[model samples]
Target: MPVVSNPLRALAGALISVLAVSGCQTLDDAGRVIGRADLVNDLAARLDRSTELTYSADYQLPGGRNASISQSQDPLRAAYTYPGGKLTVTADATTACDTSTRKPTCTVTAPQAANAEPSVAIFADMRKRGLVAPPVVVGLLTAAALDPDATIRQYDTTVAGRHATCVEVDQLSDAETAAFDACITGEGALGSFTGTVDGTELEVALSRYRDAVQSGAFDLPAGAGLIDRRADGQPPA
Candidate 1:
């Protein structure tokens, strides 16, 4: 959760504290009430709503690296493939595979496991490695929606053969967000994004997107070692 140094966050913290006590709005340098309680709220809304859509998206990342996301609803299962690992979450279990070793392996954890530690650590690690998934991007937009001095402009673009609504967020007063531009397709899929989030510069684009996912999209990688802690109650190894 490392973030860029923004002297203003301290000021924001102070102002927010006062606002908490005084029930007043936080104002920016121009004395304007901060926060985009306006139309920009829809941008964040779109990203959040994307999680409910059943689709598979491939993202082209910087340095020729790539990632993909496949998700389905009703049961709410998702699989994300990053540079060296894959993380899948299902109603029944959380499965993660680390391919950094000579032989990749998957560790499975029950839904009721303590704190869901394995997936939590893996997710935090991925976030630090510049994974700008929809949820993470949503957090950035939410913060901007509250920053009065932040400037947001809207435009249109096409990604992966689909039209998308894009927004550029800049001149933010927050410490963590540097520059953010995201495109959300009509189907609620993230079309593309470029910029920094929490000190991580993430450049990603949707190469292809499909509203339907293939069978076994959530299955663990084939021919890998397995650690089943779903019932053993043992720590992840």
Candidate 2:
């Protein structure tokens, strides 16, 4: 894993002296701060790094519901699977799978086509549908870093055999109550998170992790109907 630069850490340390240490909330002049700079900065940096890596991770949502994230680069793609459905995105196609029925069907769309089936607003759609995806947690942590009024208490724990730093943030005002808690692994993957987003309460913990993505990480449902809305109307192989 790449450690954040030294100059960034030095600046964060100075801010910590003036600010309180209850929870580490780092504010960059902009967003380029170092890892371990503060609780919030470190976590935010970890999540930001995770976006570029290739891996597959399993998560256990609140009430034992299952979810997962499979991500890879090259063409740049990812799949977020939760309970009964999944959403997969790539440079050319966006696919959403509905598995509640006897036969699962996937609807594919050209990412730039008009009236895309899954909608180009991918992250917003997942949060509205109450999916506990990792990227959403990343957003929360990133926001917390910029909140001056947010106070955090730090803790340490291990999730899926990886050590993670955890924090609980308490916001003084209603405007700042963004996230409740978040944990980040050394490799920058989200270890766990719990909070209300867009009015829905979501809680999830990492259950398993693989450093490398497996074959067929972006594969759609096996033996399912396909609705391809691309210009060519060709199905995925």
Candidate 3:
């Protein structure tokens, strides 16, 4: 008996199996190398020990120029994973796109990430309050000599509903001051900030923060208590 082999059929079957495997992966898996479940668990663990907070109502620009706007308060989730257990936070955030012409634009805030916290316990606190991420927590013990201390100051105190922890950097030397100012003002820094985590040496950027703000992306309220002011006279929230 001669066994006939169907090459066409065999190739077709192989293609179907590959497609099935591809569909199993989540967005994070395709975009980045981290696993979806692992990133989620890691984020949840860090947020556990953290607190809850909210943003100050974003004010309209001076010229009546509006940015995209929407509002959301759902618990946060891990959207992407970075190396060393770092993760990007995702949630349904609000946006306000049109203000002057009254055209009313609408869009959900996309995923925003924070610096990685030192311990996994912070995730626990994030979960208790329906939040997906934790705030930046700077340690006092890390302060160095002569580095002008900077504070994790906050505004819109009522919106946060609590006091944010203040961590000052060591006195800033003349050179350091220049660098810090540049970094804060979006001149030569890495990128936009989202938020900070306690016990971590990460500095977020304005782009990340704006993404979170525009989307109402924050899940945990604990980090909301912190504020950063702009030199352009925009009030901190």
Candidate 4:
């Protein structure tokens, strides 16, 4: 499949790849050990315990276009709202892709629409069409921490009036000499992430976090014009 060039997904995939190559003992800036495998373990535990989460961030793209993104996550469901479009992927692997503006409403059904895990379905749909989408900053961080080669070191920092641990990924590429920074809260939830791509700097900060999701957030709006991808034999956009 041809690689899709969605800037956000590309950035996420790159960050994840870098973290995958790095080690696990977290440390302070002074080189003193804070905890062994703290970053990895905390992220894992949080994801396992939380039934729902919400993330909101503003993104500055390479061309200087600004975007605001909001995401809601549930056990086997997720919804992304950005600009004029909204996408909801249900636990059954059904994706309702809708745009409030010019685009048409569409539904794409995955092969495992009935039996697969929600996370599995969501991830697969995100990666379909060669797109490397990470549903939220927390999701990306959790995935990176789970990588066998991931080595995350922590430094002290503050974000949004909250004390945080800054986890860094250095040496992403020899030519670029760039580092990725993800600041996480004491409970391992994502606070913010900052990195540069193609000379454009991007930063995402979590403005809100929740432990429960509203059932209606995952439903397609009433009276929406629906285009079934399966019936039309069309590709997902």
Candidate 5:
């Protein structure tokens, strides 16, 4: 899996701090002290089980730009909607792994410039979609779990009038500094996430979650003027 960038790292760091400050001891269901590794593994497990989820968020980017985000996901597909609906991204996992490198790959289609390179379409689409690649939620969680210096502590909390488990991590070290707090519902869905990256803050909350994805939610809209990198093999028309 590709590593998460500084924004995500910072979000993970803030989550960790929040959980730690909640004053709950690091104890799992088995009554053992939840270490850094254990927490990461636990969160990964929960994320894996969450095959479908939907959420909305407000973000404050590095340049102090405020944006609204709506996202939905299932096991094999993910979609995101930005403010004004001007840019939306949906990526589908066409193959589980590359034949030569055995690395995961996907087919991403999005609106593109007439001069954009075919090879760069997917990456550019990801950047336009707030850098959220396929399986956005799980990808973020997985990246945080892979952090070597991450430490997790969990506590009980209430969010949006619902019971949740607040998991926090501390001392996350990647190529840059970061941390985050995540509130997971009892049903194993992310209720909310709060974090800071390089001093910029981001927060997201789940307004709705379901095991089933809406019809056509993952499909490219009619007349979206999208460019398919794998098919066109040329610049946008």
Candidate 6:
């Protein structure tokens, strides 16, 4: 199969690759480990806990009996359509509450959506609620700053009537572009290099500068943006 260029997926894959490289480094940056032991403890604490959430809707039938419909937030839990009677929910490890005594405090707040996924809104809500740890933003920004060879470019384009931010290498050489595409296409070994971090020689995969451009994914967005943003001799919008 041709390598599908999903920027979000690609970014996620890159983040996972960073984690796979060094457990310690991954914890320090991505996992938010104040200490190795603390990190281990946190993971251990979450190992056995379970969480479950279900949204239910009720309807009144011609008879006295009522009908109930429900959906579970648990990813592992399969959805089922049941008779108009009762909906039972059991907590799972992924979505369980933090405490046992109190009612499962897993709260769900639906955000007003206008084009973005509800998950994105939920993430924004979590940020507002101080429920999510801001790690990746710090990590990527830090990587961009500390890493001198970092190349970042902003390409805004419409996709399926929605605007998207396509991040890619700013000024890529032909050879670099080829290598990047090859890496993503699985044609060759993903790029890597050695660098001195804190005086220790560290082998780190070189960020693929060309991967985002390989094939038609890069061109389509570029062309669309050009056409959409073109106002030949007019003031910018």
Instruction: Show how many residue pairs clash in every candidate, following the order shown.
Output: 1, 1, 55, 2, 16, 7
Cα lDDT of model 3 overall?
0.24
- The sequence of per-residue lDDT tens digits that candidate 1 reaches over residues 1-237 is 112121112222333333333224445543333324433445545544665578899999888888888887755677888877888866556677877677889888765333221212336546555466665555566566667667877789989899998878898997777978988887767789898766777888999998889887777667768888777554432
Model 4 lDDT per residue over 21-138, tens place:
3344343432322232345445444433332345543333333333333445423444554433456544333555555545457576643322223243343432221122333444
Which candidate achieves the best lDDT against the true structure?
1
List the RMSD of every prediction in angstroms.
8.4, 8.6, 21.1, 9.2, 12.1, 23.8
Worst 10 residues of 5 by lDDT: 92-101
**How accurate locally is residue 193 in candidate 4, as Cα lDDT from 0 to 100?**
65
Question: Which residue pairs in model 2 clash with each other?
Answer: 23-152
lDDT of candidate 3 over 175-212, digit per residue (tens): 32212111111111112122223322233322222224
- Candidate 1: stretches off by over 4 Å: 1-35, 112-122, 231-237
lDDT of 2 by residue, 166-188 (tens): 87867724453455787878887
Among all candidates shown, the one with the greatest TM-score: 1
Question: lDDT scores for all predictions?
Answer: 0.66, 0.64, 0.24, 0.46, 0.43, 0.24
Model 6, 137-214: lDDT tens digits are: 222322432233444443444322333233333222223221111001111111221222222232222222221211
Order of the predicted models by TM-score, top scorer first: 1, 2, 4, 5, 3, 6
Error of 1 at 191 (Å): 1.0
Candidate 1 residue 148 C-alpha distance from true site, Å: 2.3
In model 2, where is the ten-residue run with the lowest total lDDT?
1-10
lDDT of 6: 0.24
Q: Residue 181 deviation, candidate 1, in Å?
A: 1.3
What is the alpha-carbon lDDT of model 2 when measured against the actual structure? 0.64
